[model samples]
Target: MLNRDWHKTYRMPEHPTLDQRVDWHLAHAIACGCREMPDTIKREIEKRGLAVPERNRPN
Candidate 1:
């Protein structure tokens, strides 16, 4: 099982921006083995003119 509260353990940047938060979530989600990406991450990616990739699942 994944730890949903993992994000709370980190010290957020002094001026936390949307991109920073999205990066944090993306890292934690990957560490927790989440196959689906969050909406925030998706938005961040699109905002930077990037394409959405397929979800990665562990075997």
Candidate 2:
């Protein structure tokens, strides 16, 4: 189920910085379940040693 409300409210920036991408993905993980974070983003997060939110984990 797409979270239209969250999408409408939280558009990704045209040219996002690394921190912005991380923040957006973290928030999106909590607010919506439309899709998984992209592999590139996952790798970046891992490189930074940031913990993915619990809700974002695949079951």
Maximum-lDDT candidate: 2
Badly placed stretches (over 4 Å) of model 2 are 55-59
Angstrom error of the Cα, residue 28, model 1: value is 6.5
What TM-score number comes out for model 1?
0.42
* Model 1 per-residue lDDT tens digits across residues 1-59: 33545445654488979878666555654555354676877888888887655544555
Each candidate structure's TM-score, on Cα atoms with residue i matched to residue i, is 0.42, 0.72
In candidate 1, stretches whose alpha carbon ends up further than 4 angstroms from where it belongs are: 1-16, 25-35
Global lDDT scores for all candidate models: 0.62, 0.79
lDDT of 2 by residue, 1-59 (tens): 34877889999899999889888888888778468887787788888998776564334
